[model samples]
Target: METKRFYQQRLDEWVEESRKQAYKGRVAEYIPGLAAAPQHALGIALWGTDGQFFQSGDTDLHFTMQSISKVFSLLLALMDSGEKSVFQKVGMEPTGDDFNSILKLELVDPGKPFNPFINAGAIVIASLIQGDGPDEKSERLLQFIRHLAHDNRLDYNEAVYESERETAHRNRSIAYYLKDNGVLEDDVEETLEVYFRQCSIVVNCKQLAHMALVLASDGVDPVTKQQVIPRRYVQIAKSFMVTCGMYNASGEFAIEVGLPAKSGVSGGILSVVPGKWGIGIIGPALNSKGNSVAGVQLLRHLSQDWDWSIF
Candidate 1:
């Protein structure tokens, strides 16, 4: 009880510290759809293993899962196809480029993407899910996410999807190239539709915190006392989260925060505590690498103070 009370104190202090950082990061503007986000938007939330929730700031804003969804989709693919089959399509190593780069894919000589976190790799992995159709597969995937977070109301961010789709000319090019080279299965357009839709699914910090909580608990929903995802799948997901979840800054983040984290342009960060906790953060302001500016700072502070890194 003392420890729980102490954590609550720290959470309040941390939330206070974060509001001061509101203007330190710029809101993502490259995509016209996300450019207009309220610059100071911020939120922090944590779900303990005991079914207690700790949340603060703008906790209700619906933001897309963005890159964070890569972890779940990758887990689903691994569960469906097993390790060897999925890894053969995409690698398990990190690429030191931007997440959506076509440059490294070409340099790798038509080989699979460096890891499942990058857009090229995620798109390929999305193609490999054993789905009857893109929509059906997406529906199933959303249902899975809803169950994990225990939030049935979490739904697609249609405006973000349309915005991403309209601006996804680069993703289309990558998908077509992979199709021509035989890296992607199913139809290129179909795969991209699924990929974009997955990216567009939106949730608040508390929901994602619960999702991360399950992963941290090794695929069991700590609050519900149910096996939500396979342990094997969680292992694979956590491994990638440490190595490739942070885009190019992953190595540094892994060293600093020491947790498996996934960041997105939407300024949402989802992290696994690997048998401990699941932390979710959101701040619309982004650093140059497309991470939540204040969120990253907050995690780094907490990880260092609490020694939460998996390494």
Candidate 2:
């Protein structure tokens, strides 16, 4: 096992080597707040189940969770509604389409979302969260995230939330379509509000890494040794992460990096070297399929150098 000193010595060199790939991608612009991010910025943090920690580059830089929030929301939904109820709203299989594509919702029988990591499925999962209204639901989800991250101060980036809410025509359309198809039980706008707020939750790489660490330990907090989430739900979440987390590039990532991971449009990725480390990365530049270009490169390098691939 590599010591913390060894990681600290080499992490910066690895990060800079990976930063060069940022030139090949661009920041997401559909959301005004996200477009303002530095296109070349790259950062990473790693937290080990054995209590080792290492970080490099823009690790302190804060960004919205974007689609990465879907992972936690899915977990919370499973806890609230159980596997049977949650699966009734979203499928376990990946769609291979763009994360926001609604084509399958129209053509697929039952008209349900293919998986929770996608926008449509995430919206459906949001409705499954137990609460009397959107505000309560959003708060409950945020509290769950805070608990997983072990940080009580974590909260929303309201600017990003408003920006997403204003420009989310496609998401709005998908929600309404699901409503018409008998898939959505809550009010369209209310469920969408919860989904938007969850995506807008602000977090740094370190905080994200901590959250991933819980999953790496099978829903246990390494420091406290407490079961933060049920093991079965963590297994379910990790399976989805492997198959559908990186938008349409999940298969490629699974083959190359071989770790369960989730990526967000804000250029954040939460990945796990199961039973070992939880990794968080932020590189605002995105490839055509909406994943962090430099972040993925960095993970590829580390996975190869350290043989971190679970496969």
Q: Which TM-score value belongs to model 1?
A: 0.96
Encode model 1's per-residue lDDT on 151-238: one tens digit a residue.
8998898888888888888999888888888898689888988898888898999999989999888888776678777888888888
After TM-score superposition, the amount by which residue 178's alpha carbon in candidate 2 deviates from its true location, in angstroms, is 0.4
Q: Highest TM-score, which number?
A: 2
The reply for model 1, stretches above 4 Å from the true place, is: none
lDDT of 1 at 147: 88
| Residue-by-residue lDDT tens digits, candidate 2, 1-311 | 55767877678888998899999999999999899999989999999998888899999899999999999999999999999999988998999999999899988875799999999999999999999999999999999999989899999999999999999999999999999999998999999999999999999999999999999999998878989899999999999999999999999999999899999999999999999999999999999999999999999988988999989
Report the Cα lDDT for candidate 2: 0.94
Which 10 residues in a row give candidate 2 its minimum summed lDDT?
Answer: 1-10
Pairs in steric clash, model 1: 258-309
Instruction: Please report how far candidate 2 places residue 109 from its true position, in Å.
Output: 1.6
lDDT of each: 0.85, 0.94
